[model samples]
Target: MREAGKTLDAALGEQAGLQPTATILKVIQLTQQHRGLSALVLGGVEGVKDKREAKQKEVDEAYEKFDALVKDFNNKAIDDAWATPKREWQDLRNRISSGAITVPESYTAHTALIPKLLVVNDLTSDLFGLSLDPDVDTYQLIQSMYYQLPYLTEETGKMRAKGAGLLAKHEATLEDRQVLAAIIGRVNDRLTQTHTALNKAFVANPALRDKLEAQWQSAYDLTNKVMQLANTHIVRPETLEFPGTEYVAQTTAAIDAQFAVNQAASRQLEIMLNDKVSDLRKTRWIMIGAMAGLIALAGLLARLIARSVSMPLQQAVHISERIAQGDLTAQIDTGGSSETAQLMRALKAMNDSLVSIVSSVRGSINAIGEASNDISTGNADLSSRTEAQASNLEETAASMEQITATVRNSAEHAREADQLVGSATSVAARGGQVVAQVVDTMGAINDSSRRIVDIISVIDGIAFQTNILALNAAVEAARAGEQGRGFAVVASEVRSLAQRSASAAKEIKELITDSVQKVEAGNALASEAGKAMHDVVASVERITGIMAGIMMAAQEQSTGIEQVNQAISQIDEMTQQNAALVEQAAAASESLQQQAATLQDAVAVFTLHERDAGYSYQSPAQLTPRKLSLVSINGIA
Candidate 1:
């Protein structure tokens, strides 16, 4: 029973309805049967880690879905249903969905009572509109009564209560209604004063205040007519025109039908409960039998295990104690059990292994002494070899010094040759005159681009002025008379043309300005590169002049000392700066080649066919617009 209670608590703590109670009962029964399954899962169930992680994920997903369902219920069911139906049904259902209400012991249990704020029977369809269902279940029936009140008081009523009459605190009974009637009298007097003021407003502003007075007349007429209609409605239906009052009978019938369903559900649930209880009784008996069988089996296994295990364990202990007392000569009898005989054999093996281990240790000590003497002889040999290696190392060091000096001179000559080769290559590949011409052209193009940007700026300014002029022209055209109609038409056409021209010109100017700036910047970069190339050429020439003197000095040093001459000769250089320039030029050419290869990729991203133009295009800049933009002569477009 305690186990069942725990299961029930787990399942139904936050659950709802008679259905949920049934579910909880089933869970309890399942738990009782499966008793230690949860322990087994923790112990080592197959795929336990995956199952646990999946279940946790399911639980989190359930929380999110449940939250969404509640929000949906509030938006779709609660707020919407309240607005459409005066019944408390929607709000009650919302509470159930939101987990705000406890699960009912019986599904139809909650609707038995309602707050007095809801005048359930006295409701009008106009105030709390009809539910689509003529008869509702307990949940829906409850919602029907909630919408009626103080509940369905129109916004106008709240507004009236908020006015100077202070109807909110009036507590309108027959006494307060009398006060309200007095307040209404005072309201009418205020209306008279307002009527005068509104009439004066018409005198002050005829067009506007006349509309206000019209609204006042309509509102006052409607209010008086409504009061009269209400009185007539209270007096006799024959004097009233409203035809839908018969729905009251329909509503009562609906409430009755709802009550009938509740009673039926309640009775049906009782029957289901009785059947469940009967099944549970049978289950309890089964559980007791199962428990008895388990207990009996446990006793039998314990008895069997004791006879098999304890005797062997005690015998093994005795043998172990005897061995512990230094009984090296002691022997154990196996009594024909292979496992027991194996233990005896293991003991004998241990004794033999220990004696052998002692003999092996003595041999190892004698061998270690011999190995120490051998190590001493090896160390003497190693020291003799190391002394010879040190002498060779000194010779290697001198060779390395000579090699270092040779590499340094070779590096210098290579640097000079590299520069000269690069300059020669550029001159051969592209003539010096052509290079100078290109540089001069770039400069001229750069100046022309600057002028183009200025022209674009002037055009933009003109467009702005033209727009202003068009606006003024339009206003002038509006003021023109019939005699000036032809002139006005001309002015209107001019204004339209001016607006079109201005917009087109502005767009064109922006395009021109961007192009000009790009060209000017490209020119400046080209000019700087040309100057760098020129400086490299001059530096290479200076190095070539220094190389001759270096070679002559090395020859004189050779006569002074032969070894030092080899070191000085290491200063000889072969290549110069022209080689480095050639490499850079090659690198730039390679980049240009790769860029040409991807021209097809550029075309792939843009669909010329879809553009319905000469070409479909998007700027690379569009991919990362904020990545630093070029500062045009103007500003950002």
Candidate 2:
């Protein structure tokens, strides 16, 4: 029972350890299943980020290309808005003064300025859309730069176109000069506004300042040239030359600044995305490592628990095997306060009980053997006396003339024979009682043997259960995989121990079963012996009745003596048969004694602490007394 408890505890502990691990494993599997989805989400984020980066690059390239286009148009506009108008007016002034061209012809030449003026306005409009597209309100310098700068450029172009058109009449009129003067004033106003706005943009966005300063100077110089040309109105000196190379440098720097701003924003975004991806990868590996560590720890704990439980049980099983083999000398140390310890204690106690019972039974058998010897001695004496009587009766019959004396002698002998026969009947009755008691004792022994079988059966059941538990532990260990291999070996060893225990229990059970069968056979033999003793008593009673008849008929002495001789012969024959039966009974008792010795030897393997006094007994009369007395008188003890 205690062993079973230990096995059950171990089983429960194993299951307890495995259940959580199984749950954790299931949870890990569930989480791992989601890993793919999580990876997909991360991949999607990366894809979107990549796409955004690509789109940003495309936008940057397009903006740079557009800025270059604006730079080209801006360069042309500067020439047309300022340098072109100045050079044409100076030519006209020289032609009129030197008298090479008429005033009307100069007027027709002034029409040439109209087309350049219109081209300058077109360049200003294109700059607004390409380089200075409005994003914020006009309050911001960036927006004001786009709006006001283009407005100033367009106003300058218009001023040039108007001044040239008004002066192109056949005669120079006061009204035409007045209109041209107004145009010059407006152009100066726009130039001042454009310069102020450009300076503000440089201040607000300092990154563009270095590059914008040069362009601002170029535009300022162009404004001054346009103002000079407008003041003369086809009358300036021929010092006017288009500043085309300076205009190109300013436009290039402006375009480069805008492209640089776009590239910086895109690069910053790409760096942030790269950092985010790196952090996510680190986090993923960390999670995977943590999960693996937890699983390893759980497996380690399970292995430790399995070893702790299995080792002690193996020791207990070894001890139990010795006990089953009738080797009670085997002792076990219960290592600690565990179920296996309790089992060891229980087995020790059972061993002690068996030793006491075996010792007591040995004592009882010895006592019974002594009583059988006494019965055999008494039976031998009775057989001798009967033979003596038969010889004397035959001698008296040989002298028929001494018939009267012989008749009286025969009557006296008949009374003595009747008394002896009554004694024999009393002895036979006692022997029958003894045999009945022996039958009862044998029956009791059979019952005890049966009980021992039952105890063995219980042990077998415990072994079987332990075997099942070990098998279960092995299966759990197998499920634990590589980490569980150590536990699996332990479980296998435990299973082997259980099997050995079961085998020992089975052998003990078989021994007990055989013992019970022998006991039952002994009981049946004892019962038969009791019935035989009763028949012996009946035969003795018949002899006693015939003896009484001989005492009553003394006058027919010869006839009675003849009958007496026949009865004596019959008594002698019966006495000889009783002697044979006594010998058989003594032989049976000796055989029983040998069986008891064998039983003692079988149990002698055990080392007992103390010997118990054998079982109590009744007086001989109460315990197979009939067989005792029958053997006592039959000259066989």
Candidate 3:
């Protein structure tokens, strides 16, 4: 169907391509007439200058139409071909209008431009696909329009130019006659070619022949007449007699007749191309409709097939969804022996298994809850007893601490008593040494008193001798008389002094003897006190040794008590830790009981068969209760 659409597009494009060929043909015809008129006017013919200007205008207008048509084609090669002719036309018109051109120059210029326009016509036909028409009738018609008819018209135009130029000059040269003869021969040749093309077109399509026969015959006759007139009046004669303006008119009439046939052929070609494009478009739509009908029929069949397979699968999906949502009690009817029925039976067995599994899980969860409760209760009782033991141990530790402190204080006091006894012993030993020195001083004082008594006895004996010497001196003085009276008084005074000296010495001796006796008594008492001090020093030393022993024993007792206290504290701390552990175990067991209850609640969401209710089953591992000690529980927990 898509390929048909492309063919239809191509046919329409070809039809569009044919549109510019008509304008191209029109430009060719107008330029040919303008070429003939240019020759006549430049030949100095009267009354033809205005005709030439007018024909030039007509040619320019046809060029405008050709420009518009070529623009639609958008083909650079065709446009370029048309531009050369258009430029030459303008230059010829300017030369003729400026009167700067001679007869041959003007005629040559116009002739040059007409062939360029013919080339443009051929190019336009090829651009429009007319030269390559697929059908025989259209192809023949294209040959006539693009080649045969243009060639015939060009030859006729040449005849017109030459004939008109000779007529306008009223003279004919041999060279001019030869050129006219040559143009005549070419004209005959083009006429034959044109007839052959038309005959071929007619044979190919009798309908085109019926439509174009009269125009073709008219063009044929007019072409022949123009040839005859040229041969007799312009080529054969040495001088010209026909009016140049009338000659241009007759030749133009022949060219117009040829163009008329060309137009008819173009119209027939357009009609045929249009019919071809229309048929292609109709066929494309027919194919499109047939394709659409086939697509609709396929879709209907596919829908019926999908319905047959999807319906059963949808039922199976629905049942599977129920199972996923934990509806284990859903019933299944496996009626058919198809694969889908087998799938339903599998799902039924899965549901029954789930019912049994869920029932067993529910029973296990209940048993776990009961065991956790019992464990929690036992932990609570153990916690109370452990706490009580920790409390009693705490009190015993406090008492031991007090005893340890008392023993430490007693040891400290004993140490202080021992230091005091050592100080007293040192003081007593010093007192004994002082007492011994005092006894030795008493003995020395007694010896000094005895020496003093011996000195007093010697003084008494000297006083007796002095008394006797005084008596002798008195007797001598009596003999001397008055002069000796003074000597007698001196002797008497000496005797008295001697007597007093003896008495004083006896008193000193007695006092010295009494002091020596007291010194002896004091020495004896100091000797006895020194011995007592020595004995006191010895007793204090013994007491210091005893106190030291007592202090050492007290210190050892305090150390032992402190070590016992530390042991009791450690035991108390362990008991506290045990109590805390018991509390933690009680809490953990309670949490386990709650978790088991939660598990039971979670399992309750699954709907089970009534026959599975109260169906308790325990595995061999769960038949007897497992007892775990505290150490094992601590490790596991």
Model 2 agreement with the true structure over 446-509: per-residue lDDT tens digits: 9889888888888889989988998998899899998888998998998899899899999998
Q: Is candidate 2 or candidate 3 better by TM-score?
A: 3
Off by over 4 Å in 2: 1-402, 555-637
The ten-residue window of minimal lDDT in model 3 covers 628-637
Q: Report the number of the highest-TM-score candidate.
A: 3
Q: Indicate whether candidate 2 or candidate 3 has the larger lDDT.
A: 3
Model 3 scores what on Cα lDDT? 0.80
Candidate order by decreasing TM-score: 3, 2, 1
Q: How does residue 450 of candidate 1 score in lDDT? A: 70
> lDDT of all predictions, in order shown?
0.41, 0.54, 0.80
What is the per-residue lDDT of model 1 for residues 129-163, given as tens digits with 9 covering 90 to 100?
Answer: 22221212322322322222112112112112212
In model 3, which runs have C-alpha deviations exceeding 4 angstroms? 300-637
Q: Write the per-residue lDDT of candidate 3 for residues 1-637, one digit (tens) a residue.
A: 6677765666666677666777777777887787788777778777777877898788878888878877777788987887777777777778888989987777777777778878887777676566766678878888887888887888888889878878888988899899999999999999998899889989989998899999899989988998999998888876678788878888999999888887777777778888988898788778878889989988998798678557767877887888788777676887888676787788888888888888888887767766776676667766766776677777888898888888988999999999989899888889888888887887788778778778877887888888788878888888888999899999889988888887787777678777777877887888788888888888998898899999999988988898888888887788778878888887887787667667766777786767776434332234343344444332222
**Candidate 2: worst 10 consecutive residues by lDDT?**
28-37
C-alpha lDDT of residue 527 in model 3 = 79
Tell how far residue 540 is off in model 3, in angstroms. 99
